[model samples]
Target: MKALVLAGGSGTRLRPITHTSAKQLVPVANKPVLFFGLEAIAECGIQDVGIIVGETAAEIMAAVGDGSAHGLRVTYIQQEQPLGLAHAVLIARDFLGDDDFVMYLGDNFIVGGIGGQVADFTASRPAAQILLTHVPNPCDFGVAELDEAGRVIALEEKPAKPKSDFALVGVYLFSAAVHEAVRAVQPSWRGELEITDAIQWLIDQGQDVRSTVIDGYWKDTGNVTDMLEVNRSVLETVEPVVLGEVDTDSELVGRVSVGEGARISGSRIVGPVMIGDGTEVTGSYVGPSTSIGDDCVIRDSEIEFSIVLPHSSILGVRRIEASLIGRRVEVTPCLRVPATHRLVLGDHSKVQISS
Candidate 1:
């Protein structure tokens, strides 16, 4: 079996960050989310993989290369535009010829991996098998309506009034029969060919469209909020290992991983935190759920529940939390002027001054 990983999308939700970088390349626990998915796919023993890339194709190519690192031979399939999931499959027909394949969204983070699901699909050979999870807002996702018998009754893409809370997760398993289904479906009102529509086509043809509701952690790390949440989740399982130097003046508490050549001096670091290689933390309070990237410098500052990217520096800043700082950023104290309230008063305007 082969794998088709969809890494093409205009990540508008991530804004300035996405403007500079691909959303799938965003780090969770100092590692790219796309790498995690690729590793999972490799673990499932799928060696022939095809990655669908768009505008940020160069970056993805540079990072993944031959995919030998993940035990897979990757073939890059360029999709000029991210039309839709079904469109991706349409373009990858040659690469996925005749073989059953798994489609994984590049930015999705599914804890516990997809090995079990792959095993189950290989055993039964379902026409289409989808992973479903209960999300708070079903309207923002492709939702599934299941019958009392736990059979997939209908699928809707971003419905206004969702029939169920079960949103389709990014991982999907399909047999060779799905190619016919994709060919039979038409594009939705959104102009793009929706994958949900193709799956619905299978249902209409009496094909076995199966679904499994995953209870474990799953997140679509397309935006900042989910990215931070995934980061926090991945960090929870981190085993503390101190590979670098920690001065006598520095104190480490709880679970922390200090990478090679990283120096911590005159600082108090509380864990569930990871300090990357060659980083320096001095006279700072590094709190939980924070992953500081390699070669960063954190001096005389306090940060928690944040991700500081590689080569960034936070010096003499009072506090930072629940934030995402990009690479090569610098955060320092700004010169302060005398405290004063200056304002222009309009006619009949009443204002209260802080004295």
Candidate 2:
């Protein structure tokens, strides 16, 4: 079976960062989120892979060239516009051919990988197998309703009145039978061809539709809040390794991985923190669950539970927590008096206040 990875999405929720980079390329523990999915697919011994890319196709291609680096031969399939998940399958019909394939969302992060799920799919050979997880807000995701026997009987896309709390995870396993289902469905009210509709179509035709509720950690890293949460989750498992220089005055605590060329001086880094290659942390308190990406500079700033992307700088900022800083961005101290009560900020732009 081949693998079809969907790397195309506008990522409007990620805003300014997505404006500069693809959401799939966002780093988790200094590695692109897409890399995790590709690695998982490789582990399942699926070599022939097709990546569905949108406007940022060039960048995706450049990062994942021949896919030989990941032990897979990749074929790039361009989608002029992101019509829907089903639309992606519709366009990749040629690449997918007659082989069963796994459809993965590039921005989604599923801990423990999909090797087991792929193995089960290959064995059971269901028409379509979807991974489901209980979510707090089912309305934000495609939900599935189960019968008395716990079989998926109905599927709804972002339903106002969800019948079940199970939200569809981003990974999907589909046999060749899904081609007809994709063709049978029309666009939703959002004018996009949702994959949920395709699955519902298969159910309507009495095709075997299966659901596996994942017990492991899973997250759709589409927005900033979820992205930071995933970053923290991944960092929790980090094994401490110091490939870079740590000054005598500096103290490194649990599960910290300082990459080569990174220098830490006169600072204390708590456990579960990652300092990417060439990053410098001096006289700062780098707390837990923080990932400082490559070539970043953190000086006199106390950062915790944050994701600082590559080449960014945090200088003299007293504190930053639960924040997502984009690449090449700078956060500096503001020298002014502060008097704030309530500020109504608009959508999708940076806001700074003097303090």
Best by TM-score: 2
Over 4 Å off, model 2:
336-355
TM-score, candidate number 1:
0.94
Cα RMSD, each candidate: 6.8, 2.8
- TM-score against native, each model: 0.94, 0.95
Per residue, candidate 2 scores C-alpha lDDT tens digits across 1-355 of 9999999988898877788788899888889999999999999999999999999999899999999999999999999999999999999999999999999999999999999899999999989999999999999999999998989999999999999899999999999999999999999999999899999999989999998999999999998789889999999999999999999999998999999999999999997999999999999999999999999899987888888888878777666777788887766667763442122112233444343
lDDT (C-alpha, whole model) for all candidates = 0.89, 0.89
Q: Which pairs clash in model 1? A: none
- The runs of at least 3 residues in candidate 1 whose Cα sits more than 4 Å from the true structure, single-residue gaps closed, are 335-355
lDDT of 1 by residue, 202-264 (tens): 999999999999999999998878888999999999999999999999999988999999999
lDDT of 2 at 48: 96
